[model samples]
Target: MKRFLAYIHRLIFILFLVSLNGCKEKKANILPEVSVSNKQKKQVVYQVFTRLFGNTNSNNKPWGTLEENGVGKFNDFTDKALKEIKDLGVTHVWYTGVPHHNVITDYTKYGISNDDPDVVKGRAGSPYAVKDYYNVNPDLAVNIENRLQEFKALVDRTHLAGLQVIIDIVPNHVARNYQSLTNPKGVEDFGASDDKSKVYDVNNNFYYNPKETFKVPVWEPDYSPLGKENHLLEDHEFDENPAKWTGNGSQLSQPHANDWYETVKINYGISPDGKKDFEELPAGFENENYKKHAEFWNDKTVPNSWKKFKDIALYWIAFGVDGFRYDMAEMVPVEFWSYMNSNIKMKNPDAFLMAEVYNPNLYRDYIKKGKIDYLYDKVQLYDTLKHVMQGYGKTDNIPPIQEGLKDIEHHMLHFLENHDEQRIASIEFAGSAEKGKPAMVVSATISTSPTMLYFGQELGESAEEDAGFGKPSRTSIFDYIGVPHLQRWVNDKQFDGGQSTENEKALRDFYKRLLNVTINSSALAGNYQDIHLFNRKNTKNYNDKILSFVRWSADEKLIVVSNFDADTNQKFQLKIPQDIVTSWQLKTGSYLVKDELYDTFSSQFVIKNGEGTIAISLKALESVILKIQKI
Candidate 1:
């Protein structure tokens, strides 16, 4: 009995070896010469928090100061670093926290004043509250006086590495104590000429709180704006007599502690009643491209805030930066995006214009009327996928979400991780970064829109650090601290995985391979057809836990499927219906399909009666991005 068992095991092992060898020959032909109209320049975004990307500090003390934690400087993004980012198939690098914001650090030596502690969130301050539109962050500059020069050099270096640059444009708000000492020639700071007496003026830059003083939120115990210490600013009161509106559009004199009281909101011709004070979009301009949108704005008067932000954008464009990521974009009117983004596109037509609009109702208004290149698909796709990974939502819902956005599918950017969301590896979230693999495969291959990866996402950063005002789970955008998992890859600025564990290295390798394959494939930018419905109805024992789809161009065809069942290995016969087989023009015969990611799995499909089907067994959390070889 023992001899018979050993023989059976050896035979199984031999068969597995043979299957592995067979896939190598099959995948080599995956790079087929398919016809395509597009230049096939797909975008992959790498969002790097400037203050932490190169900070190799393991100190990681909660609410640590710049000196104690050691902040990453602008110069830290070396040629090696940018090259590494580009080699990951990233076309754009979003330099988060590039502009000077309110910080607890005293840059008085650089002639920059200290920000009031009561308003700043963490010791490093919130990046969304822009203090200087015209200047780079002093904390990021090795030499504060030469900060702009350093940033310009970084842009040059990035372009040299063949990657475009993107920086934030926080149009909705500015620091509470807004001042622009670095405002360019012929430029005026926001509210520079506002009549402080009035709360609502069409021309005023900010909404006022007549006769009321701004009250600061009471600080919770153990949470000090200045690391266990109190200052005069934290007196539970502020001095804004006739207080300004908060960043979240709160028009109250004293905003609640939960309110975005750290920053003040900008008034863009929207009144206290939510009525527009500026001109609306011209008739029939809703469906027009930015070229016509810009023309519509010509000779048309806009609010001072619009022109101020426009000039800021144009300054960055001339400074050699390639794009802008608008923060809290929906708070600012869609008309402003039409005005701002239209002007931006007029300057550089290819400038990537992405925004955060969580409301699904406004997705079309932002993308079409606002002339935005992309909007965050968090409310639909990312949210659905996150729930699915946690085993609450069904994969069956993904098809309808895709179908609903079929008209603007290419404008909805997909991401499994970003600064605002919970980390995939956190206990409160997915609990393991490995769970992100199937989701990521779906996100990257789902459409022609861009795919973004947060800095530590590739290496399973838990983001559990008690970093100042911001709590754990999501990586803190507020504090200056080291990202433990990603810092291993940073390895004290070596930018290599020398210190990473085998699992961390493997996860990163998966990300690298998947991103490269995504950008190189013609089918990803081509057409998408949902095979999930057909598979669910026709294939026996198929469950909602599995998702299947097909994407193809003139050059090649790909059948993509993912198993979100974290504990069970699912076995099913993935079917390609007669209609799809005929449309794909898949010839009649047995053809092989290989996994583009990890290359650990492959399968063969035979076309019978104008239908092609393959037997697939997916391990727990396994995803197969099988490229169908031409017969």
Candidate 2:
């Protein structure tokens, strides 16, 4: 027994030495602000691809039409289905691809123009290339004429299920053919009244190239937009007498195939030289919230495109949308967001507004001046976690990331899977959904940020099948296909996971438990203290693969430890420092630390010397969010 104890002691000493050289060499020099008040539970958003969410068709043929593979309709989101989503702890549901985008479905009979096969990315079309602002996709309705009513019914049902609805607002661009056949009686379609002769004008909706005809991209052997329709649009050219700038800001008459070729860029009163020609945000508006910013714009005159989008957003808000997920928000302008988001908030004060922004430098400006509620943390949290999951990144980098964004952790939304990112279970990512458990635990609990989960993330859907327009890794956003795991959960509209395997069901259960805990935990939103460096410098057997942190509030406290290594169990002592124990006002006594995640493991800690020590052995890819109670 003495020899065994000696061996364990030597092992702990080795871990401490390696960590000291690796982690403590550069401890996080900064700390986040603390709120010693009562804690509020955080918000969680669930992103669902509207056209694919309820589709059970497994016939995933590449570039297939809606009839071939089938599409999920608005009616498919039954009350039971939505309740299942709400029960997963989602406060908001981002219904992607709800707007009317160009497609090859030939809705010409319903007065909707037939989109050219040359411009559409896939048979189902790209959602970002929105063709109509006032209409929902006709393909999503049982009767094409009643599409809007169907969508409205969805919104009403969503609210009835106690969930808010968030749809996409692509402000930076529109379809190459900007014709909204079903706009409100007084609403003019984009570019309908503009003078198309001018290249740049404040009133002009798009930048034009006079006398230049728009040419289609030369099709490659591997990719063809006109799949199985070789004879269709054999002319291979769109009849634009004066070609406009491409959606990606390419002024070329004919953009490369890689460009956002299906869409046209919206001119926000910015000249071709990138000079701002519009009214700037009033100085000191940075200190103001959405309500104040809305008041600022009440009497002010803005650019024409700004007014056009504001009206569009107002129309949606009136139509019962709770908020918007602005597509490529940074590409438009900060001032436009300030104007639009403030207006949206004015109508619905509690509306959720999130953006797909990646520039870290513009985060604060967008948050404060632009009136955005949440920004994607892809560059900082998601990217760092991705590298760490792949076994190349150091866990020490996480603290610095949180420190840098300490002031706005609440506004930063974290996620492991989204439509734009590779699936956590994909071979290109961690190769297994089990690998993301620790990452998900840390992501959902590390800070006060709102958490987001893409559909199928919980059930280990790896995007293994190539569903057209893109390769496997990310599920295709521009195709008629069904998600394998999500379809099983849908279970042909029962949504009871009747077809899920035991492993898949358990994976989903983990997500359900984790998310419910996150939305219910007061400590998650109250205070955050990184206890990693202390463990690395002082504790025995705590390595870089293990992360340690503490969250506390007036009534509740939690210590989170996650093991990132997937090969071996992490046996260590999670030591609570003297200052933290006193600061938390934890009384000196014995306590039971219960695992809130799985509720299967726990530890007994004896408090003394102004400190608390709990011995634990976390298994490979295991995590524990402990709830401490005096016993």
Candidate 3:
């Protein structure tokens, strides 16, 4: 009897040990709750056309000279100006047209060569046609000789004001006459050592039409170089022996009038027969991080063009520039990006690298393999939202896109108006600035992606000027012109909107509130679930014009709804599904719902039977962000 009792005791002790081990494994599998404040911060980019942002001149003449239009200087970005931008909740300032592009204005006195009028876009040339890779735009400086210093000062000032700086890097092409007077030691020009006798060489920087001499494009009847201004270099002739391929991949000796004739394409060792001359990335390289990618290229030899671009990017990174916006990135090879962007990350891991990749099919490849941080979400989100805004499409179309891009949603950058797109207030677009409010809300808060706001977008700047070489509807990036609405907000260097109209002021206030809320909202950086489909099926009087979604974190919960109806006021019951209610762990009770954007209104979110519902009314072109909290 004593032996049997001892055996039972031993068996019970082993069972206790087993249960303890099971508890340990269970605890190990549980994920720790992260606070909302601890989540990643969403980026808000404010893209400003540097030359036009602070220009107070309202004299927007067609093809106006620099002296006539009065360009904005680096000194124009005053402390007050930067503070106002920061107050608008902008994380980074993209200073477009900062590079030394080919311009009609002669800097020959400063040893800069004169750009032929036929090759330049306007008095202030297209920023994409970069003339000098190693210098800043001479026109943007108060003192031309000290332009680089002025830019450095502006960068430092911007940093002092707690904002990062971003600039353009036109990698796929260079100005028709590419020169780099300020290149650092031992650095050579792009095509200095290229064997011009050959049409395609692995080491050549540019692809040449060996026997074909370059000829200028046939001018259209209405358009001429510099708008037919009687400039000294407007002879309608450009000399290029062994003419290179046009920027848009036109193989003709003289490209079409509509082609990117002002710039020449850079060759990346890809043969004319569509075969790669350089080493290809091994399979499964797409899953590797930038560090591993960088290491892979450490001992490898790349094409000459790749090295030149990489050097230029690193030079800018060393010069205190925080990021780059690559123009026409998809035009270049993805392998080049993998090399360039990986090197950039190795230098500054936090560098904001965004590109203009319009092809949705190549989005993931560019992002994961190329190490690119963001691509313009123009074709999908922007087009759909624009259609909804124009009254031709329904909000129902948005959910499928969001669902489709769930894997790479954060890599997609959202914008309503850019330098390339028409203004929201333009007649060709929505015809009223108020129409952008709902779209703006949806664009900013729909995903965890970075939100970009054009400089004059807040103040309802209708691109109404017929600037030289630039027509109405889209703001002129190719000419020296002042933005009227932006100038009003400038208020003569005060950087205060004293000269703005009442409507403009209210519109700006709307943007201000929306942006500030976006950057600080932890819920926006967390998980997103679409309630639009559920609300459409369950709620009363909820139409396709009204869009709804839910976003939440460990601490905060948000229900965002926007009304696209320009003429109708909407009052409806917005419902949250039972699954989401259960996920949120909210018991049956009335919770206080407050609008984070506008504080004047508040509503109650009642949760009953594992479902949440709220009654809300939104006016025409209006939106609301309802925050739920336990009362």
Show the colliding residue pairs in model 3: 63-468
Q: What RMSD, rounded to one decimal, does every model reach? A: 10.2, 7.4, 13.2
lDDT of 3: 0.87
Model 3 lDDT tens row, 185-250 = 999998999999998898898889998899989988877787756887777789999999988888
Tell me model 1's lDDT, rounded to 2 decimals.
Answer: 0.84
Per-candidate TM equals 0.93, 0.94, 0.94
Cα lDDT of model 2 by residue, 1-631, tens digit: 2123334444543343344444455534324335544335788899999999888898998877788888999999999999999999898999999999988787878888888878888778899999998899888999999999999999999999999999999999999997887778787888877788888888788999988899888778766674556636645778776898998888999888888889999999898877888778878989988888888888877778998899999999999999899877778889989899899888999888999777666789999999898998777788778878988877877876676678888899899998888998999999999989999999999988899999999999999877777669999888898799999888988999999999999999999999999988888887887788888888888888988888877677799999999898999878887777877777788889899988998898767889889998899999999988743
Q: How do all the candidates rank in terms of TM-score, highest first?
A: 3, 2, 1
Between candidates 1 and 2, the lDDT winner: 2
Can you tell me which runs of candidate 1 are displaced by over 4 Å? 1-35, 220-223
Write one digit per residue (lDDT tens) for candidate 1, span 316-341.
99999999999868778889999999
RMSD of 1: 10.2
